[model samples]
Target: MSLFKLDNVIQNYAWGSKDSINQLFGIVNPNHEPQAEIWMGAHPNGCSKLGTTGEPLSEVIDQNKLDVLGGYTAARFGGLPFLFKVLAAETPLSIQVHPNKRKSELGFERENAEGTPLNASNRNYKDPNHKPELVYALTFYKAMNGFRPIEHIVALFEEANITTLNIELNVLKAIGDSDALKAFFSAIMSLEGERKEAALAELYAAHARPAKTVMGREALQYSKEFKQHYNDDIGLFAPLMLNTVELAPGEAMFLHAETPHAYVQGTGLEIMANSDNVLRAGLTPKYIDVPELIDNTIFEPIKPEDIRLNPVLKEGKMSYPIPVDDFGFDILSATDESKAQYLRSAEILFCVEGVATISSEGQSITLKPGESVFVSNNSSVYQYQGNGVLARAYN
Candidate 1:
């Protein structure tokens, strides 16, 4: 195959945005259901299809793995190793972590041996691959990523005057270790019944007062929003403990396995290792596997600069660097001076803005906004023209 049009899958999750995806794709939903994600890969859970024919992309890849995917990619990953998505989050997602490869394999095997149903809400691991993700902000995006510095969290809590949290905060301050952070986080998640309700009430009252610091103010703002959506949910306090990340358009962040994260609000392009094994801690009506989450979560503090991926401009493409062999991503902007680009592996190109014409060998496809095309590895050389922004995922 040279280049084939892909019919993507749109996931309608509760926390999704109403207007973003619909507006991007130019679809008007009469029922006004949330459009959470538009998936553009061969992942079994929500696989994309060949345009008009309704043939599954996964089936096509399986039948011609070596030709569709390069020989090296096919040998290493068996099929497509990456899943691409356009994610729109209006409300906060669950506080969650994904397991490393070894842990994921172990957990998947254990659950399978225990006869856990694949569709069971309690199931933790869906596949044995570790999910390391990169998010490119399409709009102003807000998220909670990794643990904040222990000292900062303690000071925030002390200033907030939450007497209930003091004990756990004190333990964290005293130990000053990763284990202490785990213990403190665990204590917060374990709060129950009247105690949990009281803690939430205290948290709400604390945010009611004017915050002294910028981070404190941010925490208060996020907490207020969280409370509005999920009243009495203990996970609402997560903003106080996790680093709040705000991404401008064109900025990107990479999330490795075992990193605790939640997308607070935003629309973005996300690409990750093809896995759906999420171990959730709290902040959802879904299953909260506290023990599993704690085991997989890394307690190390992550600075804002650490997760940010600075793009390198070369030719007309801006490449986002990620330290993974499973996938490569770049933003291709075609102007009048743009030139032909060569593909080393199978690639998926999505036009986010403007209009672009992509040509491979003798065949060409014109992609408008929200349109995507899958270029097979057999098509080695491709050229682009017309003014537009294209997000490309390869290998």
Candidate 2:
């Protein structure tokens, strides 16, 4: 089949919203479960099934890699290189960072040699691939991305009179900016016993008063919200340390390897390399290997302009250009009949809003909000008719 309607899996993580998916897409949820993510890919964790044949997408792709993934992608990546998802975060996600390709490969191999089971809760790397993802906001999405500049970070702590980090802050002031940032972060993560608790308490008390500055207000607000959920986790200090971002509808952010980030709230579409390797720091009860996380992470400040991935209009579609070859993203909107180019690689087309029909190879498939179809590389050129907003993912 050139086009297969996809039956995806919705992951019910504890941080998910109870009604976001249902209210946004009209998906049935009689159980009122928290729907965290709708996975549309061939990952072993949650492989999509073909609606017509009930065959697993991964097995089907293995049957005909070249036809399904196209020649270059097949040879380069050996299979589908990307995973797509609709991620909804009602509460804060873990403050985490992904390993780079080299680190992930080494970690995966080392863990295998150590006889650590793949399903082990203490496992740090799940696959040998790096996960660099883009989050396209469907609603007002809030998140923390990367570290703030050294001066800004110092200013906030100083203004709040947070003496808990007196020694670390002094080191930051003593050393150069770049080296100091990493050392300070490592120190913060390694904080133990009364030191950790005292710091959290001091920070909490500091935020009790209304912020006196703009940045201060943002930090205090996020810190308070996070403390509500994770009072014990030191990650509540993330807002004061990392860059806080709130993307308006239609805006997007790209998170690369070695960046410390977390999805605070709201809904978005996420596309990434087919990898599950995540090394967490805080804001979670999960096992955290602080040294491993610090070793793999790149401690650098990301400018505000660099956080959001600006769209480049190309051939009637708004393309989100990424640095990696594992995936590509584009937003296409049509209110009338629109002709599109032939498939260059395997793709998943998701209708974000309105109704539309995809026609190719003498066949047609109608898609509504929250519906999607997998277009194999063998499919002929396709066209869309009717009103809709579609997100197309390809390599």
Candidate 3:
């Protein structure tokens, strides 16, 4: 009654890898379809099914809210507050930002008042909940997070010498702060006609040559790589303006609300608030509301170390100091000395390496790499009794 096995959904999106998930999780892919993400929570869009009875996780939760989620969490969130996913990106995702709680509520309400259908391509807000994510790399993961320092951004643009962007570039150089970044970025993303062409053309030509600075070389390679998929989309220049970092296996990063970011490549375990709202900037065919994205984005520069997390290790567990209340993550090393966790909120345990058997009261479930189990708060306590690495997701 406390432990439930989940039959998760695999999202097949174009940016996914056809082989990575299969290779890492033993998930068979005979059709060779792109396996983008694995949905492992009670989200209505892709609710996981109970392995034993095939009932949707949402229904199960709705029917037994307090029993499943515990008194405090049920009272606070009304249901599950987070969604868990295994995301594998073979290419760049859309350049995008998530709004904060207040912005998300306003946008969702505004769209509803206008009668914008939720599924409409132009609809921006999906729910009134903000999505703040923490990703732990399963492989070498590459991403662009936050903005580059204004001076560095100016230097790159100055070096690229895009004649069309001269005015905006000069404006940014003159102001040289967050406000200037906002104005400059907004203008650049909103570029039209002859000016857009001239700027993009100059950027390609400049990067197409041998590199000048180390940062320039990175910009050159990423721009070329992005072009392979998006083909000169304005977002392709993201590397030139944003801070880029590669997270090694077992490394982690946090993407907070209003932060501009994009996943460039590789696989990771991502946990976020149970929301789908997204405001796109570039890198896809998706509708981009540039003004909304700009409004929601934080135009501040951050070093790779700022987003790349360093966890606190204690008692065979690693915990991230997340700022949000919607979700919490911990990695438990289960060996002969495994400690039992007293469940105060609902939890999901996913085995990532080796094999482990989780036991509660008198029941047990064996999990292999990629296998996950949903644990109800009614269980109160549970422990793992094997040698393996397990990622724990909770409220």
Best by lDDT: 3
How far does residue 29 in candidate 2 sit from its true spot (Å)?
Answer: 0.6
The better candidate by TM-score, 1 or 2, is 2
TM-score of each: 0.96, 0.98, 0.98
lDDT of 1 at 382: 88
Tell how far residue 261 is off in model 3, in angstroms. 0.6
Instruction: For candidate 2, write residues 1-395 as lDDT tens digits.
Output: 68888999999999999999988999987898899999999988899999998999999899999998899999999988999999999999999899999999999999999999999999998889999999999999999999888778888887677898998998887774778999998988898999988888788787888778898888889988998888878788788789999999899989989999999999999999988899998899888998899898887888866898889997668999799999999998856866675788999999999988888888789899999999989885788777988899998
Per-residue CA lDDT of candidate 1, range 260-333, in tens?
Answer: 89898999999999998998876788898888888999999887667688889987789988888888899999
Model 3 residue 53 distance off true place after TM-score fit, in angstroms: 1.3
Query: How close to the true structure is residue 55 of candidate 3, measured as C-alpha lDDT?
Result: 94
Q: Which pairs in model 1 have colliding backbones?
A: none
Candidate 2: residue 93 lDDT (0-100): 97
lDDT (Cα, tens digit) per residue for candidate 3, span 1-395: 88888899999998899999999999999999999999999998789999999999889889989999999999999999999999999989998899999999999999999999999999989999899999999999999888988888898887777778888889999989899999999988998888888888998898678888988888778888998888869897788898888899999989989988899999999999988899998898889998888989988888655777889999889998899989999999988775788888999999999988888878899999989999999999998868899999998
Query: 24 in model 1: Cα distance from truth in Å?
Result: 2.9
Winner by lDDT between candidate 3 and candidate 1: 3
Q: Rank the candidates by lDDT, best first.
A: 3, 2, 1
Mark the 10 consecutive residues where model 2 has the least summed lDDT: 333-342
Off by over 4 Å in 2: 174-176
